[model samples]
Target: MYSSIYTESKEMYDELKEWRRELHKTPELGLELPQTVSFVKNKLTELGIPFETKVNGNCIVGYLGSGERCLLLRADMDGLPMFEESQLSYASQNGNMHACGHDIHTTALLGAAKLLKKHEQDLKGKIKLLFQPGEETFEGARAVIKEGILENPKVDAAFAVHVASTLPVKTIAYGTLTATSVFGFKITITGKGTHGAMPQNGIDPINVGVTIYQALQELIARECAPSKEVSLTIGQFNSGTMNNVIPETAVLQGTLRTFDSETKQYLITRIKEIVKNISKAFRAESKIEVLTDIPVLCCDEKRNEEIVKALNLMNAELKIISGLHTTGSDDFAVYANEVPASYFMIGAKENSNTIYAHHNPKVCFNEQVLPIAAAVYACTALDWK
Candidate 1:
């Protein structure tokens, strides 16, 4: 099982963990990952692996084996824009940090690439190593797709692994479908500026903003079904600078998340109606715009079952979770739309009490999961077809 694979390549696995720690120390954000890109490219070069860099500026793609059946393995190369708080010796140098465990992801994929290269002659098909950037902002996967990563090799099936804090270490959580869809909206209300002391001189956008916010709550409560998972949160708001002066314009930004397409559309339409009606009531003009849209992630059940069987054969503890309709979203859905895709969770928590959630400054992953994850990546790819 997995132990044989680990014992056969113990040295390589240890090296991968070291690389992961190093990456954790020097983290980069978004598509601007020069150091990380160079590190990956140099390692590939030393191993005599062929790769293409900067497909979308910092996104790297490496190919191994030459068989007809091809599989794609992806890892996010970007870090979050947060300060480090961990006391590890290899703490982040700059303000940025690997709070989301992208470092571990990159290292695991690299390890898989190396091991797969050693067994290239035995491989039944080609393997595409995808080192993506800007996953924190959900832009990297789309950027890689735009660069033709899937077109050149033509991915038949794809797999991506993410380390989880909630799951126990060395355990695997496989979901048939992942609930992650995020939609952003910006609302601007225009009104006349006037002094607070004025009794009835001009329309106040602050009052209109408050009314709109309250109405938004009512819209969700009355319109959306409680059974359907949905969330709408206003994350940012801006208005007047002084207490006495009423600002002429007020801006509000928020995000909407849902697993149902019809519910998503209904929420968007209702949002527009609420903004319009609330503005009209206060004699103000309002405009609403959708900044971004991420579709819900749906997995191919057959492919997922295949992956689960493979991992179980590897002696990895398995758990089948009833897919949840969640508020968080991922761009991985974009790739799933085109092909059979499986997104698996690798446990990184040392224990229940010590685990920290993603995007938190104090978040850190158990590095030991790197080798297990790497092995899973290779085994899953080999299991395909």
Candidate 2:
């Protein structure tokens, strides 16, 4: 049955590629993916797979088969907030790009929907096809959970696969603690505004912001152990509008990523401490607002072994690799928290040249992994007990 799925997906490769390219052209951003959602719903309807919209019509949940034992297969369809630099014929022109290969995730899951529905009667229980939105903003999974994507049939376990543009085609990578937890925050520094020529007139928040940024960087290098994976990055910084006049407020937004809970808490505490004390020292007031707080994604060891064994027996030459870790984070941790779960990365490296990591404007993934991931998704569901 597993080998048969591989053959079926291979035969649908062209359709999968067409779907991927169609999605690649108009990569929607954040939670408000109307067009993308409609496209998916239409496709699901065409496949005769029933679905319902949640998260204010953003999150999509499609179903196949029946029984109390349900397995959820999830895929995110959001695009990054960047313009595409790749000169492909179907490159995104809407100023948003799917540089993270989420387009492939959605397409592969769609392919899986077709495959699973084709073999719906063969499923041991139920299959919940989770078409998640706003994964880039880290809101999709939580939204779906709040709207009860985990309930209804009540999922027993969940599985998701992300495409890795850097890994060679057909390579499947999986392991524990695959993604780091993230604490996204925005810091605002308020100070007195004054003319540029008056040195003693006002406090400069930009100056304070620069100092705080430098200190936060040192917090990672000096405070955290070298063996620990801790990354504190300031992705956005904004201040005054005029060059000559000092602005009243300066804002700094960044994210803290770590694999250790204790370390994450400690660093978060230290970040607040640093922001508070440093701004005060500069005679400025500061405030910290959390934008997103997601837990680390750790796959179940026993579940991982089971899935690996099944996938391997399904396709011996599948090139499955284990013991891999990534600094990048995903909201899939929300699902992993609720049930026994496992995740894997399918390789999509297209060439031997220099590789472009995810979120880059120039990044493009190999489409060959499209059907392979689709088959993997279908096989996982069909074989799950």
Best candidate per TM-score, number?
Answer: 2
Local distance difference test values of all predictions, in order: 0.81, 0.92
Task: Kindly list the per-residue Cα lDDT of model 1 for residues 283-325, writing each as its tens digit.
Answer: 9999998877878888788988887777677664544353533
What is the lDDT, from 0 to 100, of the residue 350 in candidate 1? Answer: 65
Worst 10 residues of 2 by lDDT: 306-315
Report lDDT (Cα) of residue 63, candidate 1. Answer: 89
Point out where model 1 deviates above 4 Å.
Answer: 1-3, 8-13, 54-56, 196-202, 316-326, 352-354
**TM-score, candidate number 1:** 0.91
> How much RMSD separates candidate 2 from the native structure?
0.9
Per-residue lDDT tens digits of candidate 2, residues 216-239?
Answer: 999998999988989999999999
Off by over 4 Å in 2: none
Question: How badly does each model clash, as a count of residue pairs?
Answer: 1, 0
Q: Candidate 1 clashing pairs?
A: 180-329
